[model samples]
Every structure is written in C-alpha cells, then in structure tokens.
Target: MATPPKPTKRRTYDAAFRAEALRLASESRSTQAAARALNINVKLLYKWQKAVQTPVAAALGASLDPTTAAELRQLRATNRRQAQELEILKKAIAIFSKTDEQ
Candidate 1:
C-alpha cells in the first residue's frame, strides 16, 4: 500500500504585509512581475489589488455618510495595527519573563 501525501498548511498574512504587497504590485510594471519579485502567486496579487480598490464601507455594505465611513475605515485599520502590536509585546514579555526566571 502507498503512503498518503501530506497536506500543506495555508499561510496567513497580516494587514501590513498585504498593504505593502499591494503597493509593490501597483508600482511594478506588471502584477506578474511583482508577484515573482515577492515570491507570491500572481492570482493572489491580482486579488489583493482588487480588494484595495474596493472601499471598506462598500465591502461591508455600510450606509454611513462619506466622512463617517472614511473615518470608520481609518479607525479600523488603526485598531488592527494596534492589536497586532499588542500581541507582539505580549510575546516579547513572555520571552523576557522566561529568561529572567532561568
């Protein structure tokens, strides 16, 4: 009997990385070229470009005024960034605490 092949784990990217990748794709000559440079799939690059072009309010189907919607989007982005930073700090603290106890 033949052994089964192992399944590959799906990779997760944070908001910052996706934003930077989208920026690079926009500045590059072609999405394919950008994907090659970033070592990501061309289709994923195209999807990211499409996503960036879509407004968060519209994507969420929100019915707020333009200014409020824009503000909400900015606040959401800031919250995500802060939450990620907090996670990093928590992990760093854990590492330092472990070392201090050794």
Candidate 2:
C-alpha cells in the first residue's frame, strides 16, 4: 500500500521580524545571500522588497532625510564597534582576574 504524503507547514513572520529581515536584506551584498543567512526563500525577500517600494511604505521611509540617515548609519557603526570593544574588555578582565587568583 502507498503511504500518505505529509502536509507542508507554512511559516508566518510578524511585522517586526519582516522589517528586520528587510533591513538585513538591504545591508547585505545580495538579496539571495541575505535570504540564505536568514534561512528564508529569496523570492519571499523580493516580495517584501516590492511591498516596501509601494507609495505608502516609501512615504514612511521618506520621513528620514538623507543627512539624518547618514548620521544614523555612522552612529550605529560606532555603537557596534564600542559594543565589541566592551565585550573584549570583559573577557580580558575575566582572564586577568583568573591569573591574579593563582
């Protein structure tokens, strides 16, 4: 007797996750690379990109001026660098303290 085929489950993402995924896609070199990193289909990422290109979504993004966007990008880069430095300092402290205990 032939076995029954299993039903496929569709995964649904929330608005926040969708927004983050879109942002990641824009920052990545290619949509396909971003989709692969996020474990999602490239077509789906393209769909989201199309949706965001609509008038309503475009208007929302238009609220930020080019200068403001550039400033925000710089600030985010600095913040990321500082966060990494903080993590390295924390690890160094742990190692130094461990050695002092000997």
Candidate 3:
C-alpha cells in the first residue's frame, strides 16, 4: 500500500514577536519604517494597521474612546456572549425540529 503524503506545517510566530509587532505598529513611526526596523514586511505592517484601525473607525461614532484597550475587551466580551447565545438558539431549534418530526 502507498503511504499518505505528510501534512504541510504551518508557520507559528512567538507571542513576544507578535507583541513587539503590535507595539511597533502602535508607535508614531511610518508603517514602512516600523516594518523595516522590526525586520518584517511593509505589506504585513500595513495589513496589521488596517486590521487594527478598521474596528476603531467603525466604533468612532460611539461615545467611548475606541482606541482604549478596555473598550476593545468589552466589545470582544459582548461579541462572545452574542455568539454563545446564537449557538444555544441553533441547538434548541435543532432539538425542537427533531421532536416535531417524532
């Protein structure tokens, strides 16, 4: 029998490296300059900046400061709770549908 091919490995970055990248992106330096100084690609830095900025931009109309880390955490928590509620509703609907079919 032929052996199966090995799975490709995914690249994993260290937490410290990620933290440093975020720190550099958060600084006042230009994305290109920060990426060059951090030895990462400028495109990646731009991507990170977009990902961080987009949410804050969306949240800008809110009274709370979107740039604050605490606001981000609270938003994340609210999202998590809504997701959990959605999952519970899905399971309940499935159970009820099965019961109805019985």
Q: Which digits, one per residue and each the tens of the lDDT, describe model 2 over residues 1-102?
A: 999999999999999989889889877888999999999999999999888674654666768766876676678779989999999999999999999999
List, residue by residue over 1-102, the lDDT tens digit for candidate 1: 999999999888899889888778756778899999989898988788777655664476546765875676578789999999999999999999999999
What are the Cα lDDT values of the candidates?
0.81, 0.86, 0.73
Q: How does candidate 2 fare on TM-score?
A: 0.53
Off by over 4 Å in 2: 55-102
lDDT of 3 by residue, 1-102 (tens): 999999998656677776678777656357678788887778776666566555656566346553675566568769989999999999999999999999
Global CA lDDT computed for model 1: 0.81
Error of 2 at 95 (Å): 56
After best superposition, candidate 2 residue 1: deviation in angstroms? 1.1
Instruction: Mark the regions of model 1 whose C-alpha exceeds 4 Å error after superposition.
Output: 55-102
Backbone clash count for every predicted candidate, in the order shown = 0, 0, 0
- Highest TM-score, which number? 2
Q: What is the C-alpha RMSD of each candidate to the true structure, in Å?
A: 8.7, 8.0, 9.7
Error of 2 at 64 (Å): 15
